[model samples]
Target chain A: MRRIISILLLGIIALGITLSLAKIPFGTPKTKVGRYYIDKGVEETGATNIVTSVVVNYRAFDTLGEVTVLFIAAIGLGAVLTTGRRKKPERKIEPASLVLYTGCRFLFPLILLFGAYIFVHGHLTPGGGFQGGAIVASAFVLTYLGCRERRISERGSKLAESLGGLIFVIVGLVGLAVGGYFLMNFLPKGIPNFLFSAGIIPILYIVIGVKVGSELAGIIDNLIEESE
Target chain B: MSFLNHYIYYIGAFGLIFIGLYIVLVKHNLIKVIIGLSIMETGVNLFLISIGYIKGGTAPIFSTPEIEAARMVDPVPQALVLTAIVIGVAVLALALSLAIRLYQHYGTLNLRKIKEQRW
Candidate 1:
């Protein structure tokens, strides 16, 4: 009876959300922001993608907030997982079959390079901080899962995450220090369609990607260690 | 694409979201609840991706001659969905680990009995 009641209540809530979504409109009204995109974002940002414009420039503070959420989640996971009374012995993992291990070894550098490419080119392309960061994290995940017998270097991962996070803060601070606004494009806009023109945006994205990758690695490491 | 043209799929997707929520709310098993949450998330991502798809639109990859890049499906949502899927995995892993810890304490996966940690 209790379970049934809970289901009924959930159904009602779901119906309410559905109705709300049905009524709420998407595709924002073409207004000042839309015009701004047409006027400046196309080339000045050197990005072929408008979404990158919105993320990197028009509302960069929001991206900072999003990265912070991931950071907080990583910290929270660390806190929660460490709370148990008994620390389970990190168990032995069997050496992966030669086929799988060799394959991942071949793929790891390629994936990391791809992630770095995405991060640095965020200003000139569709990929940006979050996307690139997640990609880097994914590479780490594949390495952790496939190379089970190997130990993840905790110190390196921690340094990567912390430095990534610190760089983000410093990037924003440069905006505040140089001008009043937070996350202002600190560098002078160079010739349109060039890599150097986007200023701190590309660098910031690289930092975000590294941070995300390492934080995700930490989460996986803790989970696997505990589960063993 | 069928996803762009079909009104029925939208309804079905909404229905899936609804059912998933219902399961998540009522299920005693923690894994089932997580599954329910994941299904709901997939439905949301599907809806987001579908909105960007145009009728007869080709994939975002620019290798095709028949379809121009401008007319292809918007790549923005596809990119966002990729990020969202990773976030979902992170969330799911954290949730499952917490569930494991809870099981250790209570010796069962039932939510109702795990009231010791509840506010």
Candidate 2:
């Protein structure tokens, strides 16, 4: 009975969606704003990657809010898992295979470097802080799987998280002080297609990358510790 | 045949959305419901990306001088999806943590068994 009711509900919702979606034709230019961003984004923001320009430059305040949301979720997860916890006696655990431990130790630093590379090249490439941060977090997950005894330093991850957010806010405030608006592109936008160009964009992205990476790693750490 | 060519992405995306909805609605396990929610989020993200598709268009990046601005897909939707994906991950992690707490309290992940969770 419950399944039938839910199927009926879904059928109705699907009908409504299909009817509405048909009116909005596929494969066409729908927004004037998107067109404008593509045409002038490089010249204005000195970021060859238009999406990066849109995220870290055009809608930076919105990005700040997004970061805050992620931070709150992390803090909430930590709070939810840690409160009123009873300690359990540690159980004897078999060590990971030698190959697994050695492989993780070897690949961890390489993965971290690749993630840093992605965010640092945000202005000139397809990726940005969020993608890079996710990569970094995945590395930590691998560490947990292969090196059971090893743990991330809680103080260090928290410090990185706080510092990352602090730098982002500080940059925006400095931009506001120098210019009239929040997150203004106050620094010189050098020639496009270069790593050092796009001024505060790369800086903001690098900050976001660090912040998101540490926050996600902290979340993973919390979940792993709770399970064990 | 022509209709299928244009609406394939829309169809696929909505198919995912409906399947996710069904799972969330019918599944008794809290973890299954969370997985369904994640699938729904993926469908929504895919739908958003498909909306910005332009015929014969390339990515929105201006990596080289030859890439034409007029031929690039809309950057707005891509940017929006980027934000959405990160937010989705955050929400998923939080939900999983909550599920962990729930399981600990009740010793079972079945939502039907939890009286307060029942409608």
Candidate 3:
């Protein structure tokens, strides 16, 4: 009986959707060109990846806003997790398992390199600052778990995150001053599809990656420590 | 309201979100509230994934040689969902830990009795 009811409900839903789609106008109908951006975004933005153009150039302000939110969240976290006097908590994690230690020894460098690559090449690929940054953060988490004794220092985390955020905003402002627009692509467009090409996009992605990675690491650290 | 019909999946998803929100609001049971929060998050993730889905899209993985990239589902939302899932897990773990601490402090799960932190 339930199966029948579920099927009937699904059928009704399908019918409703079909009817509604008939009414809605989905962008430029029947225009293949309309499905994609009008101009070649890669050339216009000097970024190899179209997605990068959308994030770093088209919606640069939104990315900035996101980074600021992260910064605020980190500050809030630090405040909440703050305990008795000692500015930097000296609480230490234990030594990790041999397997984790050994495995991490092998994977950590590769992961870090890959993360940097992602951030560097974000302007020419599907990934971006957010994604790459998060990946790098996970790498820190791996190290934290593996070599528990040397879990990232709170001070270090804060410095890296805040500095990265400060650098990013400074870069954006520089663009506005130089190009008469915020996050303006300032440098030579470089070779169309190279890693060092897309002027400010690559640099911005790296900055974002650093900020995000540090913030996440700190948040995780606080949560784990608080739980214990 | 008419938009709901075209977005049937999202309509149901939104309904789940409200239902979950209500659960969180009304229920005193911490576990139940956590479950509600999870359900709400699932609704959001579902809506996002559905928004990225094409009418006749197939799996994004390129297992076959003649894989048509356009026909393949956009993997971006799925990628975002994966991050959401990780965040959800972290949040859940933290919530559960807090619940445990609450249990320790109050000697009971009744939220009414644990108003020490209430502003």
Question: What is the DockQ score of candidate 3, to 2 decimals?
Answer: 0.11
Model 1: residues with Cα > 4 Å off, grouped in runs: A3-7, A18-20, A23-35, A83-92, B1-9, B46-89, B112-119
As a TM-score, model 1 comes out at: 0.80
Q: Give residue A100's error in model 2 in angstroms.
A: 0.5
Instruction: Assess candidate 1 and give its lDDT.
Output: 0.71
Per-candidate DockQ vs. reference: 0.27, 0.91, 0.11
Query: Per-residue lDDT of A1-228 in model 1, one digit per residue for the tens?
Result: 777788778768877877776553333322344445534565555454556666657666766766677777777777777864885676667788888899888888899899888888776656766777777777877887777776668899989988987888888888999978888787776754567766676777778778877888788888776555
- Give the candidate order by descending DockQ: 2, 1, 3
Please provide TM-scores, in order, for all candidate models, with all chains considered together. 0.80, 0.98, 0.69
**lDDT, candidate 2, at B50:** 95
Worst 10 residues of 1 chain A by lDDT: A24-33
Task: Estimate every model's Cα lDDT from 0 to 1.
Answer: 0.71, 0.92, 0.67
- Where model 2 places Cα greater than 4 Å from the true spot, the runs are A85-93
Between candidates 1 and 2, which one is better according to DockQ? Answer: 2
| Clash list (residue pairs), candidate 3 | none
Q: Model 1 clash pairs? A: A133-A209
Docking class of 3: incorrect
User: For the second chain of model 1, what is the TM-score against the true structure's chain B?
Assistant: 0.85
Candidate 2 achieves a global lDDT of 0.92
